[model samples]
Target: MKKFLIIAVMALSLGAYAQVDPTFEKEGDKVKATYFHANGEKSQEGYFLNEKLEGEWKMFNEKGEKIAMGNYENGVRTGTWLFWEGDVKSEVSFDNNRIASVSKAGKKDPVVSNK
Candidate 1:
């Protein structure tokens, strides 16, 4: 009976530790990151913050397409966000409490401009 109780306690302890927490792993420990799921699929992914995402986060679609990747400013997206698709990339700059600009660099700058 004592052995059985000890085994049960050990199992419970391990289970608790396996749960995601801010202390999930050390700074350099090799461990898989945590993620958020939507519609039965992994959609929003981010690093842990007290077991939650505190800084930046990335969201994706079911087809493995990136939808949005931006800062989670203390667990909430607060700054400009960048999005990408196939061969396109764009950034929505935020400044003075407004969108400063949307810069899209479609191609590399020419070494020399045509007159």
Candidate 2:
């Protein structure tokens, strides 16, 4: 039973991943790419230079809600990025595709308490 459950979960996850396969179209010097969710909603859209991610990018959840927005240069993430999680918002900064810093602002912050 455990093996069957594991296999079922794996298959479902893989199916979800496969559903968001990106599609690319050449636009001048850059290739614009757009990914779609399993429900046929836009997941993310951006531009690529020389086959590497470049310029601004926006990401959306399966429900078609914007979740993240950022910029990339030659496949390296740069500048500030904003992410939304429920009522919480996070700001992430990246340099050369590496996370530089992160800040969260919301009504609540999760913390484990031991009494």
**Largest lDDT belongs to which candidate?**
2
Model 1: lDDT equals: 0.62
13-102: candidate 2 lDDT, tens digit per residue: 988777557799999999999999887899999999987889999999989999999999879899999999989899999987889999
- Give the clashing pairs for model 1: 22-51, 49-52, 72-76
Tell me the TM-score of model 2: 0.72
lDDT of 1 by residue, 10-102 (tens): 998877555333223435422225453433445666665554445566777767678778765434445788887656778876554367778
- Quantify how close model 2 is to the true structure by its C-alpha RMSD in Å: 8.0
> Model 1 segments beyond 4 Å from truth?
1-40, 47-53, 95-98, 107-115
Against the hidden reference, what TM-scores do the models get? 0.45, 0.72
Question: What C-alpha lDDT values do all the predictions have?
Answer: 0.62, 0.91
